[model samples]
Target chain A: MENVILRDVGLRDGLQLVKAIVPTEHKIEWCRRVVAAGVPEVEITSLVPAKIAPQFADAEEVVAATLSIPGYLPSALIPNARGAERGFALGIPKLNYVLSASEEHNLANIRRSTQASIDDFGRIVELRNETAPKTCLAAGIATAFGCTIQGEVPEARVYEIAAELCGLGADEIIVADTVGYANPAQVKRILTGVMKEIGDRPLLLHLHDTRGLGLANMAAALEVGVRAFDASIGGLGGCPFAPGASGNINLEDAAFLAEATGFATGIDIEALVALRQTVETWLPGERFAGQVAQSGLPKTFAPIHRQAA
Target chain B: MENVILRDVGLRDGLQLVKAIVPTEHKIEWCRRVVAAGVPEVEITSLVPAKIAPQFADAEEVVAATLSIPGYLPSALIPNARGAERGFALGIPKLNYVLSASEEHNLANIRRSTQASIDDFGRIVELRNETAPKTCLAAGIATAFGCTIQGEVPEARVYEIAAELCGLGADEIIVADTVGYANPAQVKRILTGVMKEIGDRPLLLHLHDTRGLGLANMAAALEVGVRAFDASIGGLGGCPFAPGASGNINLEDAAFLAEATGFATGIDIEALVALRQTVETWLPGERFAGQVAQSGLPKTFAPIHRQAA
Candidate 1:
């Protein structure tokens, strides 16, 4: 409970941009290997319409298969009440809901106004309460740090949004570096203010490795007491600026840093690396980023695993 | 002087790994931009014979052209006495001499024995004393942390080699993560011991981002009074592991960090980014690595360029 809970997002964020959609069977197996290697939670897919996110058409199937494992929570990204309702029917315990802070970004990204998104969030909470009472709703503020379209999201605006989301009965507030435009100072300043305004809710950080500050930002967050992190196995996410130059922060490498810094992540980095090799070879031509995965853990590294049990 | 002088190694280290050799004129212009951006020093080329490093056949011409720029110390990597003599005679004031620490790497990489390398270093020092008395020699111990051929180089061995180079009259000692196998803990452990043995002589840490630990290791070194670093312009150095894994710490980004942390780095990042555009057009095939180069600095980050004189 004192340590961080890392959520592997490769299956969800990593496959979003790829030309080849990984088969459901292979993805299920990939999930199994990473979980076996000691990853406690995973974001398996976004609940987008199959027409748009063909890679995640099998999101329901993955959730059903992954739920059978003990000590593992399979999370899915949902945009509206409908996706939240669909995810609840499929029985995912956690729903990672997202909204954009900028009015310009919200309309461009989700085809809804920021005010309209707030309205939709209120209904999604209502749907959650009626459909599945126990399902935890972790609301993510995507591009809360900045936006490519509008640029430079003010900290006050982010704080205002987080307060509104909390008022909407959201249980968890996660700040995301959606476009990878955040520096560590920006992350610290925003997270500091947001946590102060939101007050004691589960504050999670979802950072992108855009501009290569993913890990550095995580380190800043770690110093300030934010423990839950969102990362992809082998850093598989792509850059909206380009295709995949904006890789997701690699989960195995993140685990290595957490453990290295005397923070317990309950992850075996070598096992994660082994799991990543299968993922890499299984899906050729998919861009993979992470230093520890490329060069195995240093011979001197010692991990403390199984203590969490 | 307190800020680390990170020499941009792309022209030599980055270009060496690529199959195509960049033209001499473009390289000279690149050097001009580097000097113009207030990069006080640079590793322009490795002084290996034209047969070995034909890509740097223009080393003489490059350094000679760089000498025309005032207040910039252009350095060369001298493998043997002949390379050292060549660099010294060209009037490039500073020379960085290197040899692999691991016996296997020395044999495989340079085709010389470790003990024989020590003997050659002694001769090179003698030659420098007679031929060019004012030359600054920085000794780099390659594979000092680990080796690709023989994994897990002992910390004791790294300390011993770093000590021997200083004893053999080498001006400065460089502890390099040549194989990209160093962790921050390892960097701290080895460098602390090396600093204790080789007192007050500046130790330059040449790190690779292969495992994304390049910046992490730099942070660790900063805690231990290390102020001199070796970095490339675009994180352009190739991963000895292969092509496409371009893994050098980008100098412009590193300068941003130094200035961000309130340390004094005599570099203008805006000018450096402008210089980096020169490479993007020249080497379209090259995979350049740098975060600040892609994402412009936050409007708030105003770096200290120089004293108000």
Candidate 2:
């Protein structure tokens, strides 16, 4: 059976929009529980300053706590060169850097032009090589599908940016439907092109459920042979820059989709749902989305590994 | 551009689970508004006895009211030969008949064995031939993916049922994921096989959003060349027999997905969202689903027809 990697980004992305700060201990526990549920990777925190997103104030504590969990690939989202330097100082195993394909969104999100962000990404790669050669750099193209501020982001621009990032020695390329404006056909069309440009490098899709096509988009990517995704538990997290958008595709639901469609995720869905419930209690009044948590797993469901056995 | 027919099943399937009976005048207005929004067909009501489903008590009135709308195809669900006779007597344009592929689900839902329902469907076809030759008979195989009561519904069994229904003179065949147990892979596999069996006959997919794979499953069907679907306004219905299932795919969202993916649905999404707001007020305290309603249409969104122009 083919295997897919689902990286839980709930701690960083999910908590970004919330008003209350989730305790650092709870964030660490969240990491521990999800890894126990067989998620191979977790984006434990973002490397931005507390003034920008106060919810991520305890990034160091959260990242440090995650390192103790054996066999877990802990990662952090680093927005700029300064953030990358901070992540490098902590010896983070993986650092995710994002630049929007929409120039308007890039400027709004990080106060930098798309070209400037691309140049900064190259500098971050150099910094990683010099200070922390072991750290992995994943360059994410945000608003790669479409943009709220600037409508109709051209698909050709996405391919060009992906090729440029690959040339800059990035370890991985992540295409994000940052505002959830993608359809399955667009996903198939764009991801197929991006894959061609970044030959042999790992490709991951960071999708949002804004318009209810998240899983459909993921399914389309799967058909094009994308086996890595970034999801959040309970479908937490939305882009602060994109108004009226929902959160990432629910991690439990994404895992369920992978297993149901003949791909192995190695995730225990029940455990994820249980973790979601705990998280819900921890942050009361926050909106949570996903179906498996409400209906529970179908009686016919079985993990891909078990089905093969 | 590829064209898809989105049949609004909101009046029949969407209202099936509601405890409060919606007035007949409101139902007529719903028919008028949705047709004005460019939906080609609608399942206006079910012909079951009023005592069993008080929500559909005014089936004849609803069906009659829908027929006056220009270019609109009005249909009703006919559970048995008696229901078909009621539909035939009213001169309904189309009648949808369903039998579960899972015997347990068929027994629980319609209180008949699967074979008994099949025999009854054959009788309904003969009745339509004799009494109402112009009326279309659509045979739907429910629980074609999996069953809540009986897990692991075999794919071979579904193909057999579709072929049998086709042989029995079914004018159209519909494959329903009654409990939302379908993944995109299963949808592609099953719909592909069913399409082969019912060559050149019109096929429709009846999908549910019970597990958040509704749109994803629909995308897979679209890839397999199945262009027709059954969706509900605001996702208002669920199977009374399937305990934890949510509702059918939202009509507005389904239309948006079709338009976004280069398939012409001819639906004005703004109009549907407006109607959804009115419907939500009508049925106070009912759970409504779909992201398009919550987030509104994206700035990049364009109807397929407009995009072509």
Reference-based TM-score of each model = 0.83, 0.98
Predicted structure with the largest lDDT when compared to the true one? 2
List each candidate's DockQ score: 0.26, 0.83
Reference contacts recovered by each candidate, as fractions? 0.23, 0.83
Error of 2 at A224 (Å): 0.3
- For all candidates, the clash counts are 1, 0
lDDT of 1 by residue, B88-148 (tens): 8898788888777778878877688887888888898899899998998888888777777
Error of 1 at A271 (Å): 6.1
Give the alpha carbon lDDT tens digit for every residue of A1-309 in model 1: 257888898888788777788889888988887788778888877898888778888887888787787767788889788899888998888998888886777887788888789888889999889889899998888877777777677778888889999998898998988877665656677888889978999898988776667776787677678888988888888633322247777898889877766677778788888888888887798767787876666554667553554
lDDT for residue A301 in candidate 2, whole number 0-100: 89
- Candidate 2 DockQ category? high
Tens-digit lDDT track of model 2 for B162-260: 999998889999999999899998899999999999999999999999999999999999998999999988988899988887899999889989999
lDDT of 1 at A260: 67
- What TM-score does candidate 2 get on C-alpha atoms? 0.98
**What's candidate 1's DockQ score?**
0.26
lDDT, model 1: 0.78
